[model samples]
Target: MRTRAKICGITRIEDIHSAVNAGADAIGFVFFPPSPRSVTQEQAKELIQHVPAYVQTVGLFVNASLDEIEQILKQAPVDILQFHGDESPEQCQQISSQVGRRWYKAIQVKPELDVINTIKSYQNVGASAVLLDTWHPELKGGTGHSFDWSKFPKLDIPLILAGGLKPDNIEDAIKTTNAYAVDVSGGVESAKGIKDQQLIEQFMQGVQRGSAK
Candidate 1:
């Protein structure tokens, strides 16, 4: 089976075009205020215009209230919601139901975490998928460090392996986990919020090679 890829933290029209041209399945926009890659509703509304059909546009949120999310959705046409905060299963379902959009929950992987149960908790809770990211004390995600892949668990639902993925090791990551998809932001970036076209091309090539094997 071929693995899917999502190019995240898009901030420009050229980057969106580049990601779509490079065959990314999804493009992410950060809505959290604290993130360096965060975009306002106006910016997201404009940027989303460049995203063509079949290529999903994901909105990344961190502990945002229902009203805040609703306010953002009122202007930005996001296809999916990604919760990258300490939101519980109930809270996730509540927000998704209110917004009428499928959602994904990001689990920060740590050695002490019960990987399986934590993933299973989201089952029947309105999460379409689960994204596993490396844990960091200060940051929610987009940390350029990788976690212990050996701790990864197989799941019935889609598992998106993110964190520290780049051209150099993406093939190995795919070969190892056989994850449903991979989410990348900094891996193919020239700097935060800016994507490098050449790196995006290389990352896609790596994904193809890895899936073939």
Candidate 2:
């Protein structure tokens, strides 16, 4: 199967068009207030409206309350919810089920954690998939750093590789992790929250080449 590409941290309509035209499988919008890429519910609604069918729109949240999420969903219709915080599996399930949307839990890859077990724990709680991102002391994600790819473990659930993936390294990342999909944010950006069309296209091409092998 082809490794899917998700061009995340989209803050512009042109970037959405570029990602779609470049064959991105998913587009992500941040709802975390602290993120530079974060968009208001109204903004996300406007942006999501432009997304064509079959191209999934994902909402990224970090430690947001259920009420906050519910309110956002009422305005912006996202196909998937991504939790990138210290939320428990139960919390993820509660929020996802309450909204009736499939969700993915992002696990910050750290040296001490048993990554496989962590994924399984979230899977048991009804997470549709698990996203692995490089861990940062002061950040949840979008740190633009890579973890030790060799440390990846085999998983039954869908695995999404994120963090520090660029055009030049995406092929290697896919090959190393055998991830079901790849999520990129800062890697495709001209600046924080600004996606570059050329970089997005190059990253997708790299995913194609890597998955083909």
Candidate models: Cα lDDT each: 0.93, 0.94
Task: Give the clashing pairs for model 2.
Answer: none
Off by over 4 Å in 2: none
Predicted candidate 2, C-alpha RMSD: 0.6
Q: After superposition, how far is residue 20 of candidate 2 from its true place, in Å?
A: 0.4
What residue runs in model 1 are displaced by over 4 Å at the alpha carbon?
Answer: none
- What is the per-residue lDDT of model 2 for residues 96-213, given as tens digits with 9 covering 90 to 100? 9999999999999988988888999899989989999999999999999999999877778999999899999999999999999999999999999999999999999999999996
Relative to the unseen true structure, what is the C-alpha lDDT of residue 121 in candidate 2, on a scale of 0 to 100? 89
TM-score of 2: 0.99
Model 1 vs truth, CA RMSD = 0.7
Q: State in Å the error of residue 7, model 1.
A: 0.7
Deviation in Å, model 2, residue 112 alpha carbon: 0.6
